[model samples]
Target: MVLLLDGDDWLYLHPAMSAFDSAVARGEMPPVTLVFLPARDREAEFACRSELWEAVRDELLPLVAESGVTADPGRLVVAGQSLGGLSALYAALEFPELVSRVACQSGAFWWTPDAPDRPDPLGGPVGGSLAARLRERHGLTGLRVAFDVGEHETRMLPHCALTETLAERAGATVRVSRSASHHDRAGWRHALLRDVAWALA
Candidate 1:
């Protein structure tokens, strides 16, 4: 089953609904079980901490388990765009064996107060170190990663780059697109469909 995670705003459908429906028409839309978490701003206060991720892992796995979509945790995949993309990568890092694939699109990799090379601008070591630490510490032996960002989305490049770096270092198979800029439903649908097709293929 697929999970269509919302972005930081948690209010929009991801890009590729039309493609998804078309896939459904062709019997290709993977069976999906959606779980919409709250907005990133709402969750950021606690996201750096382990509790939030732990809570999601605790809750979502059981639902999938009950549904029989993935009896083995290792077969599950997590995917999202923007903040949701960041969260998907973070979740897979946090729980390696449980998530086999992580599809990130225009991910908010720069959400931290400071970058890996910068000191904590937010006043704590943890603020700038989460992504780096995830890369350095996580075991992603079988993880498959995918990402897409628009060429015109200048503000998002650094974050997306950082995520790509980490995914590559973790031994993930990564993909990127520079044609699709950061956008609403209309903008992301094509990329999402492509990503989902690749992930499930």
Candidate 2:
């Protein structure tokens, strides 16, 4: 089974699965049990914190299992876009055993601990909080992570690029790609499919 992050943003992803389904029909990639974990509060859950992952590990997975879905805990891929993407990568960094594969699209790499009311929240950092974490040099020996950012996301490129490089440096098997459109779903669908395939491969 696979976990798709940011079910609160399901509207952004639901339509895109058709594209993935077409790829599945073409035998381009294997099908996954797409379990969407709706975030009751994205800002809280997807932050660089520990509570959310604990809940996912202790509660959410068991609930899915109880619902009669067969899932291999070892093979879970957590896919997320935007801040959720950031959180997915964060999970891999902090909880490597539970999250081994990640398909992250256009993560909010500009996030800083500074309040959002700051004149330029994006101005203070290149890779934000995650960069500092990445610098810690956690050994991600068996982790596979894919990072995709929109080609048109000029302001976002530096952060994503740094994170991509750092993840690789930390020993993860990493794939980085650029999507055609902006930060919208138009670009992410391609990322969601290609990156997940690369991660699994």
Candidate 3:
């Protein structure tokens, strides 16, 4: 199963499902269920909090299992962009049993615990709280993660680069790449598909 955060917009505006089907047809990825989950309040939910991860573990996964999708519990993939991307990595770190594969695009790596209230949220740290967490944690041996950031997102690069390096250092099987556009969903669309496929592989 692939749990996609901020996926409602991606599904509606882009031909994401079609692209998935095409990739499957070409033997690029296995046939799997895609769960597009929309966040009610992105700021609160995707802030790398326990509440969001708990809801996913307790409520969402059970519902998805009840639906009888041909999903492998051991190979679950989580894909997200921006803040959603941050949340995806957070899940992998905090709930490793639930999330082991991740396809993250342009994660908000500058997010500290108190970043939302700061005058300049991105100015506080190089890679923020996540980087510190990654530095301290080293249990990512079985994790498979794909990290992608837009090539044009210059300001976001340092944070992303630092986080990516730290994740790799933590022993995750990591794949890094750059997208063509800036901090936009259009640029992330293709990377989402490609990275998910790689994660599954």
Per-residue accuracy of model 1 over 73-109 as CA lDDT, tens digit each:
5545566776677677777776675667776677766
Candidate scoring better on TM-score of 2 and 3:
3
Tell me the TM-score of each prediction against the true structure: 0.73, 0.91, 0.96
lDDT of 2 by residue, 44-122 (tens): 7787778989988889888888989766646788899888998998898888878888999999878776736688766
List per-prediction Cα lDDT, in the order shown: 0.61, 0.82, 0.90
Best by TM-score: 3
Put the candidates in TM-score order, highest first: 3, 2, 1
Question: Which of candidates 1 and 2 is the stronger one according to TM-score?
Answer: 2
Model 3 root mean square deviation, Cα atoms: 1.2
Q: Residue-pair clashes per candidate, as listed?
A: 5, 0, 0
User: Model 3 over residues 1-201: C-alpha lDDT tens digits?
Assistant: 899898787678775888898989999899978888898899889988988889888998888878886446469999999999999999999989889999999999999889999999888889888999999988688899999999999989999999999999999999999888899888898898899999999
By lDDT rank, best first, the candidates go 3, 2, 1
Deviation in Å, model 2, residue 109 alpha carbon = 1.6
